[model samples]
Each structure stands twice: as C-alpha cells, then as structure tokens.
Target: MHGIEIAVSTVIFALRDDPRNDCTALGMPLVRRVRQPYEGSWALPGGPVRPDEDLTDTARRTLVETTALSPTYLEQLYTFGHVDRASKPVPGPRVISVVYWALVRPEEAERGIEDDNVAWHAADHPPELAFDHATIVDYALWRLRTKMEYSRIAQAFLGETFTLAQLRQVYEVVLQRTLDPANFRRQVESSGGVEPTGEYLVGGRHRPPKLYRHRAASDLADNGPLTRL
Candidate 1:
C-alpha cells in the first residue's frame, strides 16, 4: 500500500495579541488552495509526503512552501482517516491524514504569510475549511486546551520574557474563558513552568506586573507519561 498512502500536516500557531503590552493574540497561517479538489477554498498549510521523506520533515516542508513559517514546537496531534476526508471525483485512497500541531513566536511567524489569500487567523477561530479539516481543527483545539492545562505548553505560545497578564491571555484565548488573575498567577507559580527574571513592567497604568520566562525543554520530566489530568 505504499502508493496508496497519506501524509502528515501541522496546524501551527503563534500568539499576536499584545498591543497593550505589545502582545498579540494567537494566530495560525491558513492557505487558500490553488489546485483542484478544493481550489480557492481555505486549508491548513500542508501537502503530500514524498516517498523518501520522514513524516515530520514533510510537515515542516509543507509549512515552508505554504506559509513560510518555521515551527518552534511541533508534535503529532492525531490521525484523521474518515472515509471521505478528500473530495476527489477521480481516484484517491481512503485519504488518511496524520495531523500535527506546532507553535512559534508571533513576530517570527508574521513573515510567513506570503500569499495575498493566505492570512493569519486567530487560532481560536477560522473560516470554513476544506474537506474534513473542520473535524481536524476541532480535535487539534481540544488537544491544545487539554494539554495546556497539564503540560508546559504556555511557553511555546508566548515570549521568553512575558508578563503574568500576557500569559493569562494565552489561556483565556485557547480555553475561551476568563481566568481570575490571582488564581492564574498562583497556578503558574505552582506549576513551575516559568520563573521570575527579577524585572517589573513600568509602563502599564496599574501596578507593575512581574516578567517571567519559559523553562527550557530539558527541565521538564521526560522519563514516562507526559499527561497531567
């Protein structure tokens, strides 16, 4: 079944909601397909895998070709193989698609949107997608929300030196809920994913919020399971 195979793709995100503190909401680069099947329709930036390429490399290449973005944090999200994942009237397989999710800094990703039709949409909301992408998007969003609750994912979506208020916004956008400032700050401190850099923001109107940075990947426990629910 080598000829009848599928490939992996990613839904990469970067936070861009920081005008107040120079932060920005989370954004994902989307492409308007130029070829057939779903031509002119919007889709996640990705493509088929070459015979010799590894899946992750394929995902990365597709990201470059479609969106010009580099993924700072990439991981396999899930496999989607519904019977009609594709809409080809011709010949195509069952169209099994391995989905991945990635995160990058917003400033770095802004340069990735090349096409006039290609645009950065909020990671929380997007236009009507092609094929079974809607379902894939739902699954990816669920994974992101659940994983952020128990994993060190907040850093992947934020800058190294971020204020507590900025970090809270990441949770708010992804979880689609407002978090109490006191509770969120306490929880982040207790989780140990971030540590203060002995700096305070001075420009904001209210009390200066402390600045913190994300922990390096090596700091987290990597021996066994990586879930926290």
Candidate 2:
C-alpha cells in the first residue's frame, strides 16, 4: 500500500496594479507546472514537505523558493486532504495539503516577479488552477475579507506609517466597496486599532493627511489560535 504524501502551499496576497483594469487589485503569484497530472497549468507556490521541517517552515521555504517572497503576516489557513483531491488514480493513499496564507506590501511583492514561471494574477479572477487550488484561493480570500472587518490584518499591506485614505483603500479593494471617509475614520479611532504617527502624507492635491501606525500586535483583534504560533 502507498503511504500518504504530505505537501504544503501558501497564498501570498498583495495589492498590485492590474494592467487589465488599470487599477490596483488584490493578487497572488502562481507558478506554472512543467510536469504531468496538470502540466502547464498555473497553481499556488508549493511542494512536498520535507520530513525534517515543520509545516510552517515548509510553507515558508516553498514560497521563498518559488517567488522569493517573505511575507510579513503568515498564518495557517486550513488543511485539505480529501480522498479524491489529487488527479492521480486511486489505490494509493491520498495527498494531504497544509495550506497557509500570507500578506505583503505591494513593493515587496514586485521582487517575486524575477522568478521563472511565476506571475501575479488578481485574486478575484484567478485562472483555472491545478488540483483544487482554485478552491483554496477562494477560501483564503474569504478569510482575508472576514479578518479585515475585525483585525488589523490590512496593515500588512501598508508601510510603517500610512494615511487614513491609504488604509481605507486597502479595505475598499479587499471588500470591493467604497467607504465613507468620516465613518471609517470614526470607526477605526474608536476601535483603537491604529494611532497617529505625528506624521503627514504630502504632495497630494488636498490638504496633507495625517499618518497612523498599527497598535501593538497583542492589542489588536485576536487572530484565533494562529496568533499564539
């Protein structure tokens, strides 16, 4: 009897300019496979987990090797081990995939483009993926949008100091909706998720906007059990 094969994958998201729409969109990098079972198809960056490494380490190493990325916010998203998930014929034990999700700033994400067979695709409209990666991306997106409503996860997409408008844009892009400036400001202040940095963003048409930084991680909304890892 064949033993189960363990694998690791990661969905690393960043806000990037989508030339197709000429707007910034949430996207992640995908690598095109060269071998069969789903050759030439785009999929998340990952590979088989080594026995000597932990799951998280495997996820991190695969991401860096495939896209040269080191995400600022990395957390375990889910484990998928359906009996029929892999395209390979049965009789062999199922393949188990431990999926992780991460967030990185746009500038940092660009560095990943240097890798071969890797390219960024908008998360909301990814191409057909190999295996069940399409479903995995959708689930990762759901977790991201849901987390934005409560936690300061959005901060991972921005620099150390950012204006309220900039922060609001991150939400608008992920949530796919516009927000009232006054209301968003009030809500964020009341939530104490951010604090003024005593700095301001200049060079825009309007008055300079004050910049803010995220509160300490411990003070932010709980990210469930992953925060303790």
Candidate 3:
C-alpha cells in the first residue's frame, strides 16, 4: 500500500470596498503555478506539509510564502482526499489536502498584489482553478456565509474599530444581500456580539456613526463542535 501525501492550502478572503459598487465583495488571491501538473494554472496558495511542522503551521507558512499575507483569522476548513483530486496522474500515492480559510483586511490583500503571479479575484466567481480548488473555495465561502449568521466571524474582515455602517457592509458583502439597517442593528445589538467603543467616525458626508468593536470571544456565539478545534 502506498502512503498518502499530505498537503496544505489556504483560501484567503478580503472585502474589497469599491466606490462604484454600493456593497463590498469578497476577493481572494490565487497563485499561478510555475511547475508541472498544473503549470501556468491559477490555484490556491499551498505546499506539501513538512514532516516536522504541524498542519496549521504548514498552512500559515504556505500562505505567507505564496502571498505574503498573515490573516487575522485562520481556521481549518476541510480535508479533500478524493482519488482523482490531483491534476496529475501519479502511480505512487494519492494526495490529501488539508485546506484552511483565512480572513485578511483589504489593505493586506492589496499589498499582496505586488507578486506578479498572485492576483486577487472575486471569491464568488473565480476563474477556472487548478485541482479541486474551485470547489474548495466555494465550500469555504459557504462556511463563511453560514458562520456570519451566528458567530462574530465577520469582525475578522474589519479593522479594530469600525463604524456600524462598515460592519454592516461586511455582512452585506458576505451574505450577498442588503440587510435592513435598523433590523440588522437590532439583531447584532441583541446578540451582544459587538459593543460601542465610545468613539465615532468623523468627517464623512453622512452623520458620524458610532464605532464598535467585537466583544470578547466568550461573549460571542460558539461555533458548534468546530470551535474547540
């Protein structure tokens, strides 16, 4: 029996606040492969796991090396080990990918564009990706959308202190719909996921909205069984 080759991949998402577009949209960086199997194809940033490093560490390292991004939120997404997942036909061993999803600020995502091989693409409508990366990104987006309903994961996309409008924009972008500002504010306040920072965003055309920050982790809803991991 052949041993399975383990690898790590990360789907790093950022909310691009485009002035022309009313709502922000999710974007992620994809790297163009320079080697065989899927040479010149766009794919998630990843690498084979080292024998000594833990899976999460490998995920972080691969992300940094490929995109130079250190996301504020990183979590194990899912594992894919399908027999035909690899683009190349290898006779030795099947490959298994431990995928992770990360959330970084828009500025960080923009900085990553310095790499010619790495470019940000819309998460909802990415071009054809190598291997099973397209499917992996879709699943990761689904996870993010679902988690936004309960967990305070949306805060990860924002800075330390942000206006309610900015916070709501994160939700609108990820959820792919406009939320009723009044109702959305009520729901979030009732959930106790955020608290006012006694600050305000000034100098905007509109009235200054109060700045808020996510509450302590314990105050947020538990992400079911996965939270422990």
- Maximum-TM-score candidate: 2
Could you give candidate 3's per-residue lDDT for residues 1-229 as a string of tens digits?
A: 4777899999999997555766467988899988767778899999999989999999999988888899889888899999878845433457899998899977786564678898888899998888889899989999999988767888888888888788888998888888999998898889887899998887865768888988766323244786676
Model 2, span 108-203: residue lDDT tens:
976557867999988999988988899999999999999887678898898788999889999999999999999999998898878998877867
For each candidate in turn, the TM-score is: 0.84, 0.91, 0.90
* Pairs that collide, model 1: 16-24, 16-25, 17-23, 17-24, 17-25, 18-22, 18-23, 18-24
In model 2, which runs have C-alpha deviations exceeding 4 angstroms? 88-93, 204-206, 217-229
Candidate 2 Cα lDDT to native: 0.86
What is the RMSD of candidate 3? 2.6
Q: What is the C-alpha lDDT of each candidate?
A: 0.76, 0.86, 0.84
By lDDT: ranked, best first: 2, 3, 1
In order of listing, the candidates' clash counts read 8, 0, 0
Ten contiguous residues with the weakest lDDT in model 3: 215-224
In model 3, the Cα lDDT at residue 206 comes to 70
- Which sequence of candidate numbers ranks them by TM-score, best first? 2, 3, 1
Candidate 3: residue 130 Cα off by (Å): 0.5
Q: Which candidate tops lDDT?
A: 2
What global local distance difference test value does model 1 have?
A: 0.76
